[model samples]
Target: MKIFELPQTNPLSANRTIPNVDSRGFHYKDFETMKPEDSKLGDAGFYVGIKATCVYHSQTERIALHFLDFNTRVLTMRTHYPYYEEERFAKKYLSKAPIWRKEVATIDIDILYENDDFELAQHGVSCKDKEEEFLTQKVVRRSARDHEFYAGINGTWEPVVKNYFARKEYDNYEFILKHIRKSNVLALNEEALIVSQLWKKRGLKRPMDSLLEPFARKIGTDKHHLFRLTCVAIFLGHLRLDHKYEFNLRTPLRLRPDGVYQFSRGVETAPWGF
Candidate 1:
């Protein structure tokens, strides 16, 4: 998971003040609070723009490059995807660093307001589980299973609407800032895709219908498609998912053809796995 590192000489800092702030006059906090902005600000105070390629394990895994503009706090992640021309251009021109940008996630950071008003929004991660419990709130509800399911836990769509599928979008906004803090770090947007694909392969359909379906109904998006994006954020966050690998107490043994026990290297030679 090699990520690009932010350069020491920030393109944002130039004739700037100590307390960095965006165009809206929102003063920047330390890396502890502001994460990458404080470190990447360098001397520019606040970054005006950022352009970096997001390469995963190899060149082919070069999915997209995040273009973050601090002035507007709008992370416009542009990739060579969805369009046939972009694909053909990538295949012919950017062969070594080929990428696809078919689908994109434009995150507005302003939504993550750390206020009490957005408390339900914070529970977006738990909406799916809650939806199931609501199904059986009343007896003999099988007659209106479809209606009851959508009615939700508290008999309204307010929770589903507010909670929706925002946790992922909110986290993505933070992830960009975290990775961009170091000018040279290569942010590998992995784990989530793999996990989501694993779920799809397993033929699980609850997450889409429960977690993302509500959002799609309200906003007119494909629930299944939206879940993939949500999974990425869920996998990225430490609280939700631990993408980092850890070694075991001791290397496990593997049986060879000759009946000899040999130390086993985990699949992909990763440090640990089941």
Candidate 2:
């Protein structure tokens, strides 16, 4: 089994310092990052927000220990298994929100194992080709509207998380059971949904200005109130989250699987509420 010891860092850097914590992600909230828990196979618990997270199999405890020796921002994190289930609401008020990003990726634990034959067979694949194929599979191809969304902001992206998974997993992790028959931390054995919010390289270029404030004004609401409403919309399923790509404040928001849900504007007492 592979053990990921905490990286040794300088004693002075503030944000980069590592601290042992729980894998529940309780320590990763202050930063503007979002991820969807898409599993249904392990222990259920809260993550950064009051949202339900996803993890599969009985390897939860193994996964949790990796939280040690690292640190990140956290406000709320709800974790669960992400096998098969319908979207559930923590409340009814979130019906008309926006759809965000959602990424479904298959991690190659094949490399993490000791199968020399598999390695030689897969050895011909270059890391560069592997990452490109991974993105093509995980990120949605740009639709007309997707093109428009990125164009509006002059956005840019590059292949990041090449071998690092801020979050990642297999479709049928039992597949892992069929191969690397052993017990160890998921951080190593599973090839892990390991790693914190930031890494040595990130595929994000944050917008330079305040996109939320300006849009709030356009919609006749203050940024704070609008921001909260947006969060609610996301939590309520108005927005879908594919954590594969990184985002900043000004990313042109769009609905997914379909278009945005437009609720009847009548009888609503406030602009920010239903």
Candidate 3:
């Protein structure tokens, strides 16, 4: 339920001028009309990513960080995730599985809600009766089944909320950014279609190092090329990882527990402008 903090309606300075028009067009005098460009924080890109759902010209032509929902098996744009990765705020949450619409009226009515345009539906069950209703819709953990952590303005806060699943998700993206080079993503040009041929339906858990040299030799490609592709596969859910642990040559990977392959369901959606 926590929302992002924006500038107050009345500025502390007497000499500053407030504009009549804001980026969204005509607006009221409330602090709600702010553009983050006005914020004092030096890391504008950090806050911008939360409030605006994007960063300007993120250097993605080569490599872009992306988030993959473990449950939905969908990859969202790099900007589309919670700010804080901590999950302690979830003290109010409860474990619940997805339910059918038909079963809701007769059984569970506590967990569902609607989108403003009604064009989108979020299917999270939280902070309420496990069998009767979903409790706290205001805030939820992403790892929680069917919950959209970014629901409402909850994700754009000043001190980002702590979310475990969100952290894990971000961790996945962060690891790629720090270790994998843009040259690697571009040079190999590995796509889901290419990765699919790997470890297909094996559902076998194996160390990352195990696949590298062999797959490279099998496909007649370089080990470095095949390794980066494997990382991409991990992010796209063609393979699964603990994520809480950092990636290394020895990282353990297994088929998604569901034994279902997302194929390219999420990775394809990542914005790689080039």
Candidate order (TM-score): 3, 2, 1
* Model 2 Cα lDDT, one tens digit per residue, 1-274: 1112222111112223222232222232232122224334333232221211322222322233122111111112222211111243212226764432342112111111112121111100011212354355434342223333323433211221223223222111222222222322221311111111111022123341355465456557666544444433333233433333233344533323232222111221332110
Q: Rate the local accuracy (lDDT) of all candidates.
A: 0.27, 0.26, 0.34
- Structural RMSD, model 2: 25.4
Q: Give the top-scoring candidate (lDDT).
A: 3
Top model number, TM-score: 3
Q: What's the TM-score of every candidate structure? A: 0.17, 0.23, 0.39
By lDDT, the better pick of 1 and 2 is 1
Residues 85-146 of candidate 1: C-alpha lDDT, one tens digit per residue: 33566566756754434222111121111122212111011112224443554512432432
Each model's total of backbone clashes:
25, 43, 11
Collision count of model 2: 43
Query: What's the CA error at residue 149 for candidate 1, in Å?
Result: 60
